[model samples]
Target: MTTASPRWFKSSYSGTTSNCVEVAINLVASHGTVPVRDSKVSDGPSFSVSASAFSSFVAGVKGGRLGV
Candidate 1:
């Protein structure tokens, strides 16, 4: 098991808002998970989804399948 910490970052398309979603894709290779959290609540609850699931979610968002 890797002891690496998450390196979180928000999308560049999020503009200057502090309320955007943040993701840590760094864990995908080591843990098979993509951690996600709200930028506005840095110390709040966060969740992790499978790497494949996160990739699908991103594809849906980019393809406008989720209706933006």
Candidate 2:
């Protein structure tokens, strides 16, 4: 079976820097997870976390609970 490829994108608030991460939300429906990877290394390793968990992480970042 062929696997779906991630449509990766970084946050709009992310500046043009090498320190940002890219995420693909496209798999949430099909895979129930969000894939994340380093923007500086597109061909490097990538991993996925549950949708709810990813949402919580984003919320924490926005709420300043993540401390950057």
Q: What's the lDDT for all of these models?
A: 0.93, 0.92
Which candidate number would show the highest lDDT if scored against the true structure? 1
Per-residue lDDT over 1-68 for candidate 2, one digit per residue giving the tens place of the 0 to 100 score: 33888999998778877789999999998899999999999999999999999999989978999765
As a whole number from 0 to 100, the lDDT of residue 2 in candidate 1 is: 82
> Ten residues in a row with the worst lDDT in model 2?
11-20
Compute the lDDT of residue 53 as modeled in candidate 1: 96
Error of 1 at 37 (Å): 0.3
What would the per-residue lDDT of candidate 1 be over residues 17-63, giving only the tens digit for each residue? 89799999999999999999999999988899999999999899889
